[model samples]
Target chain A: MSTSLYPLASLPQIEKTPSREDGIPDGLEEELRAYGCKLIHEAGILLKQNQVAVATAQILFQRFWFVTSMKQFGIGDIGMGALYLASKLEECPIRIRDLINIYDLLLQRKAHIRAQAMASRLASTSAHPRTEFKYTPMSYFGNTFYELKDALVVAEMQILKRLGFNLTVVLPYNTLVNYLRVLGLTSREDVCTKAWGYLNDALQTPVYALYSVPTIVCAAILLTTRHLGIGLPSAPENCWWELFDAEWEDLWNVCGYIMRLYRERTSEDHTRVMGMVAKKGVRQWLEEHRPAGGEGH
Target chain B: MSDSAGPSTPSRKRSRWDIEDEEAQLEQAQQPVKRRSKTKSAKTSPAPEQTRSSAAVEPQRTTAVYKRPPHSIFVPPRTLHPPLMPSRSVYCYERLNSIEEGSYGVVFRARDKETGDIVALKKLKLDEEKNGFPITALREINSLMVCKHENVVGIREVVVGDTLTQVFIVMDFIEHDLKTLLTTMPAPFLQSEIKTLMMQLLSAVAHCHERWILHRDLKTSNLLMNNRGTIKVADFGLARRYGDPVGVGGLTQLVVTLWYRAPEILLGGSTYSTAIDMWSVGCIFAELLLKEPLFQAKGEIELLSMIFKLLGPPTTHSWPDYHTLPLAKSITLPPPQPPQLRQKFQYITAAGIDLMSRLLTYDPEMRISAVDALKHPYFSESPLPKHPDLFSSFPSAAAGEKRRKPYESPPAPVRAADYNLLTDFDP
Candidate 1:
């Protein structure tokens, strides 16, 4: 009877590596990580622009890449599929055609960027990108498009399988709004708007992945109130944090994760992150014995 | 230790806790990376055991954590969101027999092995659907989550089979739907009994509408009743949260079973409110009174004519916006006829007729709101609605649970095939 149930706890997601021999190169893997972040952000923008609820779409994007790596699928198609799935789950269905059309347009634009780069880099390359006026469903699957529309359909299914069809994703936005109302912050428009902004930024991080909705909401409130220099009751089960049963440490972790996301995206730590981290013992094992190691480039 | 977890034995059977302890001991050996890779290769292929493995292995605890072996394209980071702690699946529930299916899933009456409680297990249709999990199933969960009124059927929990694709939404097992009661009851419902059922239906609808949600599909089949005469609104596959009719969030024109659909919907009107549901309630009220459908037409045109025949056709005076309606120019309906409430259903009272008229009005704007309909003079006129405790239809709860024949929908004589070479398919 409890509405707040996460069914996926019983169905743990196993990491799928196609083959150790064909493992992604370090540069490409790092690029895909950055690409995953960029693609989900773009997906967030697309959902907002198209009037689809942004929370579900953002959550779906974050959950999708966790199931499968970018090496096995196109991030664009998967992100679009994630958005489409979110729209449906949220009970605000955008036409599937509308989503497919948007994806096709993005593909066309990416093609244009590639064409310019190719023209600048190679004078005599024969495989010139197709310069279609507009992308139709037919043209999208044709030529260099390489049947991406079909891939989107297929990848969506694969993503769901990886998720184990655990579609019940709870958002902190609703809980935050209710908590704000309960905390009597409705009249405080400035504070409410600031908290709303923090929540949006928090959506882009693993704050949701690591913490529960209550923790994320409490984290947003804490960050917002601290920025405004507002005095708080500073006690558990009081006016602000009392409504939630979340740990103060988890709330701080939620804030910390968002801060890390910001730092990772803007700083030069983007490319060097993989080599810099303590990958520990596992990669060393693969490099020494696996024949496919150095030839990955 | 990884050697003993052979291809034949399912890791699902092998508890993750056991593996964790063993894996910890293996890693503590401090052997070269080769020893670890050997373990990695062992895990990479977890055998093809399809049945009864609780493969709830958390890769986060393993070296798979952010460990990208440059050799494999498929190896994912272990830091990826930890999946929900895998729970025991639907395999635990012993399915007794198939109950009737509604919406996109087939439901079964099952017993929870752990609790021994009888519950309705709904298995959603997965194959042939390119879309992953059905949206209707999600909406049902969403609606049931928010609308916790006693009159609304609650979803107990969702369980997945051995595979994630095979999901089952478990709900409290109600023995009888309204359709079953309507057919099985020997005599027609008493006036007070009818009022009781109507009040419960309206209460549930009002609860949904108050939350800005519409139960798009509201027919006798979708309404479930326990022996206690409590009506729970069941299917929400077509239901949605609606704002103002002209609001920026557009609504799909397609919804509701045709028999219970409102006139505005059938006449090609796009936007709808709770009025459509009220109209269905009116149809249901009439059916409760007569023990059959008020308007059982084969098609849209025929259904509208049935409405026109009884209530009289819509005039410019009745619906000022009739001219702008999409069906106004396309379909030439028959001219208006005088209302015939008294002769058609002679049993209903004058107050009942007035309430019926208000509910079945051609203009949706004039339709009786659920809140207002409950306070109508019909209930106050003679026999007040009997208390729910007194309106029990079954002799006992056990009697209600006793399986009768499988429910069969009333045959449509008009649409029934009367195939004959000369008579039906004449050349």
Candidate 2:
């Protein structure tokens, strides 16, 4: 069973797959062009920086695809649907109207792809004015309580099988919250918020399934404290140390990618940076040394 | 109360029995008044069928035809008793007896007093703490209600319990399931006996597939047989109802028992269709003929490898979407293994081998369905078992009698770990 599961080193990098409207296959380049793959990559980086938000967003994305695909509903609705489902599946459930508003924000004419025109045409036919996409009561989507029940049970069984059924999966949020209270780390409020959010996002990635929830929470706390330049704990527990060492490199990579995206925006004039991203494509502009913006990677 | 009729007159006798004799007398009385009635109105009149229905002797007379359904088709009650509380609204002749524990649910021998017939009452325990009745059960009942066949378990009533605690179902009971029968057989069923069982299994499944129902769980244990050796497929706990292909439906990962699970399911593909069920049918066929389970994988990954070892690795040619599955390209699978037909199952006949190959096709579109498999050569030649009509009926067996065996259980698989996924595979 373990052999079938992909290890982190073995996982294939997420690449854009060729897709078409019906059954026809389109070229990868054309598909990428149509989807604004460049912009999505930037968003992924920005999300990775704020790990919690990224995890939440990804959860939304996967759940949306899962639910819609299961119901035999259209895949075209997945982008918005993912967020809608994710918001609930994640701790923060967003309102449908607000999510549609976010869809309008995220999908405004960008480096590539213009879904606004298509969206407006679809929206006109929608019975609800508030919602950008027409809504159907796929009670099965809400009926996820059953599926989740199964998945959670499976998850426990999986954890037991992998660890020889010994380790207990202590819930992360409670322990993290408790630790935060004890440490009195609430002084740097913005840092705390960002760290908490990043930690939440880690769950959306497959990495969550790799280790116990407590290990993740501990790593999140350590990363947050380190970024703040606070004195580390004198005597770190062996379990905490083990998680920190194993994940530090991966976490650093994620944090660096996120930090670069944010610093690029904050360093330059807000309007100017936005314009540069609009023109060069966020991915091209953020590259270490590509004559500011270029066609090729 | 037509007591004024004269004795010895044909009119009197006819008038006493039917309305025909009185029709003429009534017409004679109304003829004189017809001229006035005609002047009054002629705008609206009832249709012939409606008139005949109205003039029928009694509404109860027509209901008798419906009381006993024809041999070919049977309609179980649609609005069953509510789960749990054992509602008397749905008729049950007998009280709850000791439970007959199966792999999935608790079964009991029950009786129906109205017809003096006994039934097997299966109490399905749904985890209400987690959710409501499992979707598998929902799909099974939804499809089974519409399915009318003698080879399938006749769902007498779906009694919805008041709350989570008390839900139960009352169904027609047979004395023995196939697993019990297999124990009594001297050895593995002869090729002919195997053919008869497969035919019955296929007939039931074909009926289900025609109605867009997928029996996700299909194994020997789920198959029940009467003393006369007629097999009826039971246990719809893992069944699913799909109206169209690629519809947004639930991911049924834990569909079949690990030994009988298909490779596609093991790949973590959330939504493989009826082809998954056919794979289990193939497994059952091989098991019956070989007298042993096939491709026993202790865990999910190992289970997958075992399947690959037997059937060979699925290529784009075999399963077109093999590469595109979400989890397909993730793992770096070893070089593809060739199909090892002879090494694993050396004893099965060549005809059996052909049938197994057809039914176990990796490509769902290419896989032979139950109905098509029935037309296979395995059932074409040699001695076919007696059909339903010729088979002797046992009053006690069909009426749900208790033929207790000294508690024999299925051999538990020796595995490295128990990775029980909560999807509806009971074993």
Candidate 3:
């Protein structure tokens, strides 16, 4: 019997603020941005091969952070490799050889050739010398191809269960970038920058695997236009902005820092455009005309 | 324009988007800097000093492209070096400059104030910041305080002043954990070394069991040795008194690590006895034999499945009263499968594998006790036993003699014949 899977709930909605009054601790934005960059570098190296193992590893690291403390796992380095292992168990298997090569390439930028040689030497003693590693629990998982496949299935199911089964809805960062490409913004390295930023921010927020569809859409819109150099699109007609006001407000709350960064990167102040941005206009109207100077009665 | 029109609510929502300025005000209010602080001083104050050190040391040690807000210790900067502590404290133990943090606390190689001899002073981090030293930690400290075994990590003194700030449990600090030792080995441990470790672990656990204490978290990370081959179980954070009532909920499963978690605990069996620790010994044995975790699980669910798959399903007949526990009903186990150890661990010796399986039984009643397990024939054969006197020169052991200079050379290696001697000593 097919079971109806429940979507993971997003964290409680928090309204966005004006005037920077909420006190974003100084430097928290920069820290998260830096974290975003490292994650991109790591994911980019794996995605270049389009290998399932690498992708799974990257995603697994992302998922692990949703539960347990991420501080202990190098903020997600080892977690990347673990995702690769999980991917190997999933039907989306990639060659271990490709994993090591990508891992080497990722490190090669900063690692000396000698260090690469040592890491490579350690990498070579696996059963599948061309692809596997010395310590992979492959033998425990299987010797035969069929057994390997079965083990992968087991590992996938376990990982899903372990992660609280927060799947079904996925936030595809790469897909949003592709959308930017379709929008004629491919030349810029910064295309859909806010989208990627929002996607990453969504991962850390409590509602990661759930309640993120609208956030994703708004981010895609903001990031695409920011990179297109036309700036954020003037609010669309038919009040599409209001149709998504609730979700947009949720997005704005979780992604206030990211939106600010987008504004900072694009050379347009959000406040200067508040009169033009429909979503912000509604909040401004409410704040200005409300009794008691809009402070709660 | 549609405000006075009937059935215009949808139209108003649509027009709201037409006028971009309406949403613009909302966008202007989107800055994140104004959030009020959620931190309570009661929770923030009295955090363990080690945590503070790890935080402060980050900016000094690396280029640190990320400047994190001082709150929310959850996020670490990319490319962080594990905090490197000086061997001597800036305060009391002031002769060393490089100490390493361990599972329970920090240890520094320092000279004793009264005695000029250099000793490793392990200051246990048991403050409230460390969740106020869980019951397991108390057992480790209280139990080790009474233990005089040579194989055990020795507790020198419980340094207590008038206040909680002044308390620090001092121990004889060793150089490295077994995890560190195995990392340095060129290959997997030779059988002799494995046997030696088994003997040492059994001796210590047996010592603890005799004194009504259990070394709950027995793993390579918890076992430390000096450059010499003397093995001592280090962290007592999870060690607990065997007969003590469940002092707190959610603690029985906290003793052993995920990989080393016993079947009973995995099956949601709580309110355990010393056998819970024997299960950890079983895991360590297999890990030592295989050079990795034996029943490796991605997390708790799979870990339990791996256990049940290897040890067969646990039934009330096997584990009496297991179903009565609060979480037992929550676990839905698969049908029994005869554990197939030999097929999996082909490299391990038949005898060695037998001992491991026995120690890892699903039923605590069926699991081998530390004392009886130590008496198992495994240790009777192989490499010969070295006299305990060889470790007499251990600085802590020799505290009485005219400060005999500490041994700088590496500890002597154990050979396979040590197993032969065990067999000869056996029937």
Candidate 4:
């Protein structure tokens, strides 16, 4: 009674490969996915200021793209949707408006850092609606949260459908902590922080799609150790990844996809962000099936 | 019924029952194959051609199906959701008895085929506009999976039928829910019994809160007592992780049902925490003592007034942030009323009243937590709380057989039983 919940069809495991057959053009898949991942981090940066991990949100964004291809919906719509669902799942329920407001603020901060005065002003005014301006960032976001007010709500349904309604998202963060302890890095605060960062970044990749949870945990640890020039006891004696039966190659592949994103930031946001998002019949389908706003309770 | 019958009867070349038989046959034929490789033994029939022939019959009957659902617009998905890998346990079981209709779905006492053990089968129904299964069910499933306290209702596995549309969440079968017992029990429960029940309820809430989960909907109907007198918290449709993600824009104004809703939430406080569950537990405690809801108001406003009249108006001292909360300022305060717990519930132990006041304290931070309430002298004094296994007065508990009032009403209609009684999970 508190929230609208519509049961949907269970989603099949989509092929991990990004291709035209999966909806988005080959290059478009990588570009839009990168934009989606950026949006998640932007939300993450906002959450981090408040001391909340964006792992749940990132995983949701990754899972959403996997289940529903980019061709069906735009990157921004799913990104906003992931943020909305993550807030609730993370235990701090935020309204979509708050997400939009905070995102606007973050985008403004980013623009201010780059000294882009117009973008910053537009961001600031919209983020603070009562501060004497009304230019919302809806068009910039392909009208995701702005034009489609319940886009998050609709995307939430799509997520549940794809997940077989399984909302349990196991991020590598928790398992990474255990793995960190096993590798004697718990005392090395700086090294552990580096690992945690990698783990957060890994959340945005297809790591979860490619391997199990502990395996990703190993990959994050591996990336952290390699980046920092840390050494580990070889093989048989302290073969930690083997403890979880995780293969290093599978872990490397998780690292590969994430490492590719480091170069994706320079891509044009407009090409990836703007596009038709509400899957063809989704709006009319929404109009017909959308539950009334106020619940009986 | 006639309007649908007239048009569909002529359109359907076969009788309705005939279509149903075909559907059942289809289920039986595909059951093993649906399992893919796991149930190789069940897939003795290599009749792929026969399977296709029967599946071909499905489209016609499905098209001619009734658009009218008696109580709701229940259009099961015409295009099935793609199936994920087959789960180990598909819900292949026989329903033994109807337990009751829950907040969202119909619950049944069923026999789990593989284990040959009794379990509660919650079957979700499509809600209005035929938007598929309820997300509330998903919430409950996810919540149950994370929590493993003895006092929490545990989901065994998600059991889907041959089709993804028809599914059941297998859960531990608690013999009776508090609502059933409270409504039907013939005698006043001994104080010890009350203590035992409250202890279980509070423990469950405390455990959930510890894990950062809030059982937002905590009322009599959601508390189920097993035959051993152990009451496990059931129905997490409204429950969610409550601490970190709470920020300015994403907070939900909707919360617990009217009677059990906390003052802070009712007063428009959006950042309500686990204290809300304590407020509900307080209401449930009052119900156990008084045999009715503590504040059964006609609406939210009335409920607020009733609470204020009972506990006194919210003051800066009582609720430090009272004036600061947006909702508290929305309405003018009614004339002050003195606290009346002693006058109203005099029959309850003074210690019990002491606990009640603490549980319902206006200041959420100042309110008694489940952990603290469990340690209250009320539970320790006089008749010490009975071990759940030894205590039994809750309807489904074995001892209940000696004193439980038999519900004379025939089995209530399943879906249309009481919409208000329905919670979430299934649409």
The most accurate candidate by lDDT is: 4
> Model 3, range B1-427, lDDT digits (tens) per residue?
2233323322332333334554434333432311211121112233322332333333333323423222112211111211111122224444463356766566567666765656555555545432222333345555665455777888665543333333345567676666755554547766776777788888888887776666777888788776466889766766655444543233445657888877667666566777877888888888877777787788988887777777677777766766776677888878766777787778766676778888887677788888787777777665544433343222222222232445767655555578778889998
Q: What's the TM-score of each model vs. the native?
A: 0.64, 0.44, 0.39, 0.57
DockQ of each: 0.11, 0.01, 0.03, 0.05
List chain B TM-scores, each candidate.
0.71, 0.68, 0.62, 0.70
Report the lDDT tens digits of candidate 4 across residue range B1-427.
3354435422332332243555445434433323332222223324432332333344345754532221111212212222332233344677787766765678788887867987888877644412223445556777886676888988877766654455677888777778777777777677888999999888888888877778899999888877687889988878776555443444576878898999888878888888899999999999998888899998999998889899998877888888878876677788877898898887887899999999999999899999999999998898888777785444354222444345766666776756546754457
Comparing candidate 2 with candidate 4, which one achieves the higher DockQ?
A: 4
Residue by residue across B1-427, what tens digits does model 2's lDDT show?
A: 1232212223322333243434445434433332332222221223322322232233233333422211111211111111111133234446546546765577777678788776787766665433223434444554566565778888776553444344456677776666555655545676666788888889888888776677777888788877666888888877755645443434657678788777777777876777777888998888786676766568987877677767787887888988867778765666777777767667666777788999878877798878789888868766664455454333343344545565978667644235454333565
lDDT measured at residue B198 in model 4 versus the true structure, 0 to 100: 93
Candidate 4 displacement at residue A227 in angstroms: 2.9
**Which numbered prediction scores highest in TM-score against the true structure?**
1
Question: What are the lDDT figures for the candidates, one per model?
Answer: 0.63, 0.50, 0.50, 0.64
Residues forming the 10-long window of minimal summed lDDT in candidate 3 chain A? A11-20
> Lowest summed lDDT over 10 consecutive residues: which window, candidate 1 chain B?
B68-77
In model 3, where do residues sit more than 4 Å from their true spots?
A1-297, B1-92, B102-104, B124-138, B160-164, B244-252, B315-325, B382-427
Interface RMSD of each: 15.1, 32.2, 21.3, 18.7
- RMSD to native, candidate 3: 26.0
Candidate 3, residues A63-143, lDDT tens digits: the string is 443333222223323433444443433223345434444444443332243344445566675342232323222232344
A1-297, model 2: which lDDT tens digit per residue? 001111111111111121222111222212222232233223434333233333443433322221111112222133333333323222233334333333334434331222333344566675533434432322434553343334433332222122221111123465466556666776778657856765554533333423333345555775577767776542212223232222222333233322332232221233222333221333343343344345654
